[model samples]
Target: MVAKGFTVDLNKPLVFQVGHLGEDYEEWVHQPIVSKEGPRFFESDFWEFLTRTVWWAIPVIWLPVVVWFISMSVKMGHTVPDIVFHSGLRHICVTLMEYSYIVSFSYQTKSYWGNTMHYLLHGCHHKHPMDGLRLVFPPAATAVLLVPFWNLIKLLATPSTAPALFGGGLLGYVMYDCTHYYLHHGQPKKEVAKSLKKYHLNHHFRIQNMGFGITSSFWDRVFGTLPPQGKDVKAR
Candidate 1:
């Protein structure tokens, strides 16, 4: 969501009026609450925990598939093109299916934890975006879904293809996380970041249906949900 300016005081009680997902822009209510000043990265007790969680969980989810694909290639003496085409197609299909599942679940429940495993995984961030410590997903929670996701991938695609698709999908996840974090915290004077930051802020402020594309607006534009450009767009 877009703040008119970045003048939020973390040390004081602030009231945020958040629009519910799919709710009309005018329906927001002022929610007054006190929050502690979140610890800085180096000083936070959870810093090491967050780091280890991301490090361990990501590899656990995608590495076995990588090893499997490598072994399969060695065994078959497959060419790079053969691997790319076959495995890439499998990865794409599996990734799409997984994406659908996550989105569906998130929309249905409106809770990030119940829906997916990315930063803010579901819609929790929409409810509490300014909660700095909770702004990003905790690593331990990410580990919880790895086995289930892998098992689902196994059922949908061949062993060789599962890793490639999963790996590509993982790359997408990384891009999403980085872009999202930057959208919240980066001070970009360039056009691209300026546009994305404004787009995402609108998702927070005015148009929730639009700007669902975090890393890219590819899907948002295709789905006809993109918010209108410039001052004509209403802000709640």
Candidate 2:
């Protein structure tokens, strides 16, 4: 069955079938299992996955690294003002790197899997934004990328600077997760949220290439991908 504006090809063999009911009767039946599973409890799914895997060790993994950076900064005896300024600039750089990676992925490939990965990473929310259990990244998948990111920052910046920047970047991810979850599940009907919900829905229902930003539409506006106001954008 088609929901929202997406088309469902039930005519495909995978979705069409024949069934027998009894020794005396036989009939054709069509039933499809979309995806693999149904909704799960948000907290139960999150904590259960987090506690069971080595990937769950991510929060602990960075602690020592963060502590070492703070120690190095203190040992350097830099003035508070100098420390603050450098830290702020480094954070901006980290944020830029995080943003750049997602945008670059969009430009680098035309494969459907590449597009699906993007959706799995971020677009899934737009598709089923209110699916509460899927709001957060699975810890196992998220940890795979964290190490490479940390190492990249280490090579480009001083030990002291890298942690501060990484900290800010991590904070950005947290904000992204929280805001995205709220955008989908929160009940606020205020103008801003209403507008945001509509903007996000358009991305899912109409133009997938446009309106890529979630926490803020700054990137969409900057990249000239923002959807037109007040008009229904049709999907490709």
Candidate 3:
């Protein structure tokens, strides 16, 4: 039925029959969405398999590396004010730009490609929002995309300044993924987390196209997609 601008097939199963979790490489190839037991692959087969074991741990591993990178850059005579707000909060501004760009790009991709890319990038998670394994982008897949962004950031900003901005954006992605997982499975102890959980769940089952911002609702507010206020956003 036409709930949003797009038509959704209500009859289709939320978790489609792909294969049993981790049966074989052949079974997992190209399966974007999976059941609760899933660690599905997107376009790359070998890399996804290679990194399947470390998907959830990506934030854990990468965040500390980002910290180290930032720390080293600071030690190289670049102050936090110099690296972080070198051009008056330019670092965070660019980082926000990157974050918004990725969110919009993913949304546009899902909109253009329909179910296939949707399921691959995001729809599956919405379909099975509680599935722990599908919450974050596996490092293998993330690295494939980060290479180009790395080059772009280098060209866009100074060496001393770029890493700080890059690290900030990287941290944003990590927060988005981690916050996403927490929203689904975490019993949030804070009012803010509880509120965000309510907001994200609304995106999944109430307002599909709105509230795309996971880490921060700033963009959603700016872009006029912050989910209708005062409307009931009950969990699905």
Best by lDDT: 3
TM-score of each: 0.56, 0.57, 0.69
TM-score, model 2 to reference: 0.57
- Could you report the Cα RMSD, in angstroms, for every candidate shown? 8.5, 10.3, 8.0
- State each model's CA lDDT, in order: 0.48, 0.50, 0.59
Model 2, position 36: C-alpha lDDT score: 19
Worst 10 residues of 2 by lDDT: 19-28
C-alpha lDDT of residue 4 in model 1: 40
Error of 1 at 21 (Å): 15
lDDT of 2 by residue, 1-236 (tens): 33233333434321111111111111101121223122222235554444232222434554455545555666667555655666567555544554454455344222345443444454334334445566566656666777897798799887766666665556556555555556555665676776666665565556655776666677677778777776752211
lDDT of 1: 0.48
Q: What lDDT does candidate 1 reach at residue 91?
A: 48
lDDT for each residue of candidate 3 in 62-144, tens digit (9 for 90 to 100): 79867875676686678866665643354456446644644653433212334344455554565555566667777777788
Model 3 lDDT, full chain set: 0.59
* Total colliding residue pairs, candidate 3: 0
lDDT of 1 by residue, 167-226 (tens): 554444444555566676667788777777777767665655456666556565766656
